[model samples]
Target: MANPKRKWSKARTARARSNWKLSVPGLVECPQCHTKKMPHKVCKTCGYYNGKVVVQSEEQD
Candidate 1:
């Protein structure tokens, strides 16, 4: 195995990690309740997916 010849500088390390950020989750409006949710996933608010009730949420009880 090979090792690095020199230690990386703090600024350089910071610059490299600057782009290592968490991106906001992609959310789209739920067709059933019109609330924001992840695309193609069941809506946590309504427990629905693709216009069908995949999960029986608390509100539905």
Candidate 2:
């Protein structure tokens, strides 16, 4: 197997790893309440998904 000619510097390694980052979760508007939420998941605020109420929300209790 071919080996690297030279060792990578710490700065170069860090620069490459700097791109490894936490991205913001993709958020879409809830159709029923107009609040931001993750797509295809139950709306945390109103507990609605796919045009229907899946879980009863606290506000309605």
Candidate 3:
């Protein structure tokens, strides 16, 4: 078995991790209810997706 001849440096490791990041979820407004939701997904507030009801949302108290 062969082992690594050179140890990985901190700068090199950090540079590789520079692009590793968490990105915010993509969201869009529902045309029917004007609520923010994930693209192509049903709006939880109004239960509509692409002009069709996909879920029954409960009334907010």
Question: Highest lDDT: which candidate?
Answer: 2
CA lDDT, every model vs. true structure: 0.87, 0.90, 0.80
TM-score versus the correct structure, for each prediction:
0.67, 0.70, 0.62
Which model is ahead, 1 or 3, in terms of lDDT? 1
How many clashes (backbone N, Cα, C below 3 Å) per candidate?
0, 0, 0
Give the alpha carbon lDDT tens digit for every residue of 1-61 in model 1. 8988769988898898987866887899998899999987889999998778999966776
Q: Is candidate 2 or candidate 3 better by TM-score?
A: 2
Candidate 3, residue 23: how far the Cα is off, in Å: 2.3
- Which runs in model 2 stand beyond 4 Å of their true positions? 1-8
**lDDT per residue (tens digit) for residues 1-61 in model 3:** 9998668888888887986776777889889988788897778788887787778756632
1-61, model 2: which lDDT tens digit per residue? 9998769988998898987765777999999999999998999999999998999966796
Q: What does the lDDT read for residue 36 in candidate 1? A: 96
Model 3 TM-score (2 dp): 0.62
Task: Please report how far candidate 3 places residue 39 from its true position, in Å.
Answer: 1.2
Local distance difference test, candidate 2 = 0.90
Worst 10 residues of 2 by lDDT: 16-25
